[model samples]
Target: MTQKKRIVIKIGSSSLTSLHGEISRRKLKRIAEEVVELKEEGHEVLLVSSGAVAAGYRKLGCVERPTALTEKQAAASIGQGLLMEAYSEYFLSHGYVASQILITRTDFSEEKRYKNARNTLKILLDRGIIPIVNENDTVTIDRLKFGDNDTLSAKVAGLVDADQLIILSDIDGLYDSDPRKNPNAELVRDVKEITPEIEASAGDPGSAAGTGGMKSKIEAFKITMASGIHAFLGKAGVRGLLLDAANGTASGTYFTPAEKTLDSRKQWIAFNSGPEGTVTVDQNAKNVLTAHTGELQAEHVISVSGRFKNGAVVRLKDENEEEIGLGIINYSSEQLQHFRELDEEAKAIVDSEGLVCRIDVPLPATI
Candidate 1:
């Protein structure tokens, strides 16, 4: 019997839209069928779908994709409902219920909301319902946008502790060079790390209907790898591709990290909770934090930057101005500043449990 695992599947806009740039029912049907198969085989699946603006713009009377933010948001407002309707109809026909989740960058940035999302998704998966996630594009401003669903999928995968993340795009896999520019470029089969060479080879977005390109996909993989979730990237609409990916037999670029997986709190601090401020520590404090010897005391801090509330994620920097790591500050920036004037015995600050180090690793761009 195959082991039951929670999987997060990301479908790109190019995959869901037709040549004329509208939501294709045939494509949606195929995806629904594949997900049904996975459910029958005893795996939990959550989908991150991108095509809101692509599916809705033409219906909004635009000949091409809207360039203005409000126009695009208007299109998304119309399309999101239609998209969910199609998914719900298709999944229900196969005896599975589909649920919609509209997410924002702020949802993940706040600790309580982040955990709430996880719990909700967990409940859906546990009850055998498929959760379809999309960015809350209609209400989100440009600054608060997730940028693309690729990054959103990775964050969602990490949020639910998914066993695998399958990203289906127009391209089959990562190439050694930009295939459009170089005909001799070869597909990379397995990636242990997102090295500089790999980053250099990734090109811009390939489709007019899609916002995320290979570069964004690579960024997504960085988050998955760091979270220790295996990820696969391949062409959409391939026969049995979803099942093949779950079984580790898919023809695509596979990403697996060499390091141990991060815990849930660490995953949040590393990828989601946006650091509210910076705190520079002395050499002794840095040494203690890095070595896991003790907590960061107020007397050990040289300076604090930015205003932040207590329990906010803050960047920890060293005396030389290099970032050491991030930690949940036990005191507000104002409190820390006041405590600087207090004696050492009265200045206990961030607890060790709230601290996370290993700042040298390449974190996801969304962080």
Candidate 2:
């Protein structure tokens, strides 16, 4: 079997729908056609699409974004149908099958759900089906939301270990500053690093239907790039943008990956799962974790914050709050406290059964 290269393409609401909040069939067809061409080239493709709310609002006879959550949900409920119909029909014409996968932020919030989503997506790809993904706006709360499709696309890219994440916006590429305001703002063709300084150059959200703008795109780029997935932010209307991006053209601001694909798992661990709790370890604990040794001992811990059940993931940090490592805790926060009081033999008995009760001496004393 040939090694498959995976690509994630995200289209902004502005790129998919008209300024008047209607789905543009012509635009959708063009985008689908380009994607079909990519699939013909034997690359696995996943599309993260927006424009559901915009489509829903138009169908419901509303001309503006709804303020109420129920109204927003209603819009999404109505729009998701219209969006998938278009995608399914278009792909069908091209002799390709497109699968609609509506995911909520909750799916990626937990490990099991995230793994299930990944496996499902993999099955779709293996069957030579293009998976069209959108966030489940109808059922998600603001706290469990991806905020916008940009972040959703990046997370999806990481989940699939995509080789590249192409973000299609209305702009040709990201500029050094908001070109609309600063006429002197230069078009940055390529971005090697996404520093806070570079991020400050991004503009605000430009469309009422779209939640993310250049700023969010930059954030997505930084995230995907850090996960060893290259990200390209470019204009969507260009006739061959997708093809160009896939073939490695000097188009848009390309953020190169800094790590290997295997390293992305740890990067995902570091960035995705919010640590359940923090373990403030003494100097000795800090040294052990930094060395990437085995389990941490109870004697090395100074304090534990937040309730963490056994086998829960926790952050090991120094007294200064700098994170040293993240690992599954051998004992819960409450259990570790009592376990630490045991003597060497007693502690060893508990530790030998996959517990941590031994404490190593800390590093040099700080004056």
Candidate 3:
């Protein structure tokens, strides 16, 4: 028997829509059936699907996908419902229940809200219900948006600590070069580390229906791999594609996870939380922070910039003003400055666990 796994499937707009920009029922049904089979096989599944704009633009009386932000948001309001209805209908036919989860980037930025979202997903997945996730476009401003479903899916996979993330796109896999222009471009089937060369090979989006291109896909993989989750990227609608992906038999790009993964708290601090202030440390301070050997002493803090409350995430920079890492600061900006004038015994110490280094994350530490 195959071992049960938790999988996050990200279906792109192009994967679920016709070339004319309308959602295709035939394609949706096929995808739903595959998801049902995965569930029957005891694999827990979550879907971060992108099709709201494509499905609703026509209903909004737009001859094509809208370019204005308000128009796009309006289209999403209409399409989100229709997309869920189709998913629920198909899943219900198979005796499975499907639920909708709409989110904006703001939801993840706040720690309490982030945890609440995770807990909710835990309940749904525990009860054998399939959760359909998407960006809440109707109210999301550009500044607070996740940008694309590709990145959102990765963050969701990390949030749930899923066993694998399967991203279905118009393209089958990453290529060594631009296949459209290079007749001999080769598909990269297995990727353990994303090198500069691999990054250079990635290009712009190929489908007019989708927002993310190969670049965003690579960025998504970085998030998943950092969280110790394996991932697959492939063309959607291939027969048994989801199953093959879960079984590790798919003909597409595969990403291997790092040996060590970030813990829940650090994962959030590293990927989700936004930094509010900046701290500049001397070389000695940088060394101590990176070594994970001790707490950050007040004497080492050369300067603090920006006003932030204590316990906020702060960007740490070195004497030369190069960014070194991020940390949950122990002191407010004013407090940090005030402590510099205090006696050695009265100084505040930022604990080792609060710091996150730039080169690689330290083991369970905060800077």
Candidate 4:
């Protein structure tokens, strides 16, 4: 028997809820059935579901999306409970357990916290429970907001190192023209790359109920693909679409993974977290690092900025301020400045040759 593939399936608001803003029980049951089948097939699955605000819209007597942030927050708070309850009851009948995990952008931005989350989810997967993730809209601040579930789904894929991510939307797949307006629009089955031209073809958000338009989905695709993970977009209401897509069926638009494997730490450094500061290096230094995979040395650095301390990860930039890489600083900014003042030969003596330089190591006074 083949090993089961790990997958992440994200269902947007438009598909999971009705236009009048209620959870579509029929749709939910069909999705639940497919997911249970996948689980029985030995596949590990994670769900990124949207519809909290939509489910709450009717409950608040609002006919549309709330304009006020507080209203939206209240709706989400109310709807999240209903959404999870429906999920739990449905999955329970199928003999499968479901767990709800609400996350903010900040959760994936802190390395230690990101690792903790990864471990927690791994334990759930080990126990044969499906982890259903969502954005914590009720308490998450502006900066922590994921903006939409598309980005949240991508981040979940990266964190779990999922083999594929399936984003089920209203449309069947991407098109050269807006299918609603253009009768001759061609359906693009395979999208190995998301160029700017293809993005221009995606006109706008289909509905006001959803936060992210096609543009946001494209951005999410870029994130998932960079981590060497496959991303697919398909029709949410289609039965067995998630399973078919995961099995490499021609059901939707497929974004192929990159050739190189993006390691877990590199994934965190590149996209998971925000950098504390930046280190500027010359062209020679850039060439050595980018082309030859060289280790950083004090002689190659031009300057360091921001309030980054020793052992903190910082972004590396060239003279033009273009990001080149990220790495841990061997010295603090003040210590780096002292090293910069010395000549190349003198600096080599201190940094490379281990000469007795009067440097203030922050820990303790040792003769």
Largest TM-score belongs to which candidate? 3
lDDT of 4 by residue, 12-113 (tens): 888888767788988888888889888988999999999998888678778778878888888999899999999999999988899999888778888889
Model 2 residue 358 CA deviation (Å) reads: 15
Count clashing residue pairs per candidate: 0, 1, 6, 0
TM-scores across all candidates?
Answer: 0.93, 0.89, 0.94, 0.89
**Model 3 quality (TM-score):** 0.94
Alpha-carbon runs more than 4 Å astray in model 1: 342-367
Once model 4 is optimally superposed onto the true structure by TM-score, how far is the C-alpha of residue 146 displaced, in angstroms?
2.2
lDDT of each: 0.87, 0.79, 0.87, 0.80
Better of 1 and 3 by TM-score: 3
Measured by TM-score, how close is model 4 to the native structure?
0.89
lDDT of 2 by residue, 57-92 (tens): 867777688877888888999999999999999999
Clashing pairs in 3: 353-365, 353-366, 354-366, 354-367, 355-366, 355-367
| Predicted candidate 3, C-alpha RMSD | 3.2
Q: Which consecutive 10 residues in model 4 have the weakest lDDT in total?
A: 358-367
TM-score, candidate 1, is: 0.93
Which RMSD does model 1 reach against the true structure?
3.0
Task: Kindly report the root-mean-square deviation of model 2 from the true structure over all alpha carbons.
Answer: 4.6
